[model samples]
Target: MELRQLRYFVAIVDHGSLSRAARVLHIAQPALTQQVQQLEEELGAQLLHRSAQGVMSTDAGKTFYEHAQAILKQVEDARSAVAQSSDKPAGTVALGIPQSVSSALALPLLTAVREAYPEITLQLTEELSGTLIEQLKSGRINLAVLFDDGQLGAFASMPLVEEEMMFITRAGSQFAPKKKSIPLSRAVELPLILPGLQHGVRPRIENIVRAEGLSIGNVIDINSVAILKSALLADLGATILPVAPLLSEIEHGQMTAYPITGASISRTVTLCSSRNIPLTNAGHAVQRLVVSVASRLCVSGYWLGAKSLAKSESA
Candidate 1:
């Protein structure tokens, strides 16, 4: 099968509908279907199964999916290598960013990449830290900005920045009412709308709370930052969030930022890529741009400390 057929199949998997994939690829739906079917037949397998809900991979389809994606990526990489001989970046770079990183770094990163590498296309996905890491292992994203959580052994990690999380409550709420800062112990005394134990942040937050012999109340165990933020906005309870997650609300006076006192809450955000995949010229360029923009943001805004900012400029 042709490389274009592989691309069409990948697009169909991404969009879950031939018509939708056709629209995205700017090809006629019938033509897209024909390409995919031809490719499937050539491989002697059914690459996709359709249902009322959407298209999904069969067992054989799943196996072919991995190999097909790798072939397409290698083809793109070959093109990129050739393009790099001319000192220009072109083609697409798949990026997976955690929601928190997207909040802080995505806009500046995208803007700079757009300005500097006009020919580059960025295919993007935003997910939780866990999901982003999984995608990295699966070769779905060329680069990812997410939490380390001590679980990224398959990838090389460059620490990007560390964000100090804050314990925030609704204005005038009984918990953390307009305090400049409160000890982690005091912050945990109130109802908590934090992530459940399975979340990377939950254990650390809970450890600090449990130490003071006071249990977290109203334990809502929220998973989504948006849901947690909404709970805080409604004065339901407090949640620990990095500066990025609540920056807009805090800036707009809809929410508050109460830095945890005595003991600070923080996490290291990292830039990671698969160790097995060689970094393409475009990937390196984008990584540099991400560091540059993040450093400027940190230095200009006083959002991160000097020690943490060291990695912002490094590869």
Candidate 2:
């Protein structure tokens, strides 16, 4: 089958509807359907189960989707590899960053990369850590800053820092900071607003709480960090978060924070890339800059409640 046919099939699977995929591909719906039919005929398999709602990939379609994505990625990488042969690293580099890390590092990292590698185009994606990891595996992103719970052995990871999660609330609320540290048991008992289980930090906290033989109290689930902060300011409930996300609020006296005590609830941040896929020169440059910038931020105390993870300690 032609590469165009593969592209059409992949798009159909990704969007889950022929008309929607056709819209995204900017091609006529009939043409998209024709291409998909041609691919199915060539493969002698029904690729999708079409319905009014959307299309669901058949088992074979799922398998082909994975290979098609990899093939497309390799083709793109070949283009980037050749483009990086210049005196300076020059090409597009896609980097994924989780919401928590993006709060503190996104701006500074973007600025640093722009200043240092003007020719290397940077495409940054801010997403949940789990989503970022999935994208990394799918070859959608070249590199990512992810939370290391010591289970990501499949990736090439460089430990960046261990950031302490803190108890946070509105500055003048009843749950306002009363001490420099609050016990994990007590922290869980507070009226809490937290992200859903799909978020990286939420599951980590849940597991830690479970290990402590404690249950969270009065939780209000929120997925958006901005909305979470808004809920905090409205005196809705307290939250446990890394200081990086709410640093400006604490500094400006809009919120109060206390380090977690009784239990160590922290996440080890790491720079991760796929062990199976090699990075282009631009990708490597972006990874180095991320580590450098993160170190500088932690050392300067700009990334509060973070301790740098020495390079020798990377896994």
The best candidate in terms of TM-score: 2
For model 2, residues 42-98, the per-residue Cα lDDT tens digits are 999999999889999999999889778767876777788876764478787889988
* RMSD from true fold, candidate 2: 4.4
Q: What is the C-alpha RMSD of each candidate to the true structure, in Å?
A: 4.0, 4.4
Task: Note the clash tally of each candidate.
Answer: 0, 0
What is the per-residue lDDT of model 1 for residues 1-315, given as tens digits with 9 covering 90 to 100? 787887888788888888888899999988887887888788898889988887888888777777778677767776786677436767778888766567777777788889988887877788776777766776767888866667778788787777778877776666665558877766766777877665556766666566656577668887777888888888888777676767778778777778777665677777888898776788877877777777777877734321254444433
> 274 in model 1: Cα distance from truth in Å?
1.2
Q: Ten consecutive residues with minimal summed lDDT in candidate 1?
A: 302-311
Each candidate's lDDT (Cα)? 0.74, 0.86
Clashing pairs for model 1 are: none
TM match of model 2 to true structure: 0.81
